[model samples]
Target: MTEEIKIQAQILTNEVCQFTVDRPILPKRSAFFSQKEDAKGSPLPEALFAIDNVVAVLISGSVVKVTKTNDEQWMPIAKQIGAAIRKQIQSGQPLVAEEDVRRSASEIDLRKKVETILNNEINPLIAQHGGVVSLIDVRGADLYLQLGGGCQGCGMADVTLRQGIEASIRRALPEVEEVLDVTDHAAGTNPFYSPTKK
Candidate 1:
């Protein structure tokens, strides 16, 4: 029988400097970022750092990217973030609470708003990247989105989602709890390839 190799991963940065994993690592529910404080009542594990500093967490076969606050540096923290993720994977831990799969009233609204945004704003812009955003579903106030085409593996995908797409959605619809990208960031032709600036 042939042996199945465990997938390996690396970290990279976008134009906005947000860190993203070069490969996908599936995680479980109890597995969570060590940085989020408001997670006390939630089943998601507390991120090792704080929300302002966390970039994302691999939970339940997906990456839960965090929104950073204005006071932290992404470069100095990338190693720590990577180490934490490595340690968690080595330990085989869960990434979130099962209950987190349920949708909240606000989250439902956010999903609708996201659908509208995708149909109206995001899709048109990302068409340039040969990418598209589709609403998978919503759980609680969190909105799950799938990134397609060039956007799927583009190195700048995360930055575009967070800074441009997400910001636009939130501005148009403030009820959104959190925007989650469910795209397998590790797949697609030339995935995670960011264009260099002149």
Candidate 2:
């Protein structure tokens, strides 16, 4: 008797649900698809995005982390997500396109993408707190960021860094396992990568 692939689902947050399977959905590097447009060549993401309310999909190893709009209940949608993943696995196609397989985490490319994420997604949200984030460097798959302005030495700096900034980065760039904050806030500090200047 062939053991069927079983998916275990856990609701992580209001907008996020994490699913796991016994087999590797993505044996290689993890991938994050921001929207349906980004899922062009990735069949797994394409299928996952087809389910309504799935705003983002992250496939890391045997885990699938999906983010949906808060309007819908996860009970029904979780079933759909599991079904979609099962279909994809049963189909036996590459989760991502051959050309899209992640490379050796290029420093130049990682820097550019991380910078774009900060400029577009992260900084704007944190700016409400009068804070700014800049990339210090990329050492392998690790990121060093300098928190400035209000975030330099705020009481909630750690919360913002780990929960907000790091979560966003790790979600987008699965290869980034560590996001190190190297800001010394005692005095006003210089930014490593200034969004204004770039």
- Candidate 1 regions with alpha-carbon error over 4 angstroms: 1-108, 190-198
Candidate 2 residues lying further than 4 Å off, grouped into runs, are: 1-3, 103-198
Backbone collisions counted per model? 23, 0
Model 2: per-residue lDDT, tens digit, 94-122?
Answer: 87775444632265468779999999999
Which digits, one per residue and each the tens of the lDDT, describe model 1 over residues 1-198? 433323223334331232343334433222333235434444333543442355334243445343344466555555555555555545545434444433233444455567887998889988876888877656556778888888887878888889988898788877677889889977666544556675
Error (Å) of candidate 2 at residue 58 is 0.6
Q: Give per-model CA RMSD.
A: 12.8, 10.9
TM per prediction: 0.43, 0.55
Considering summed lDDT, which 10 consecutive residues are worst modelled in model 2? Answer: 189-198
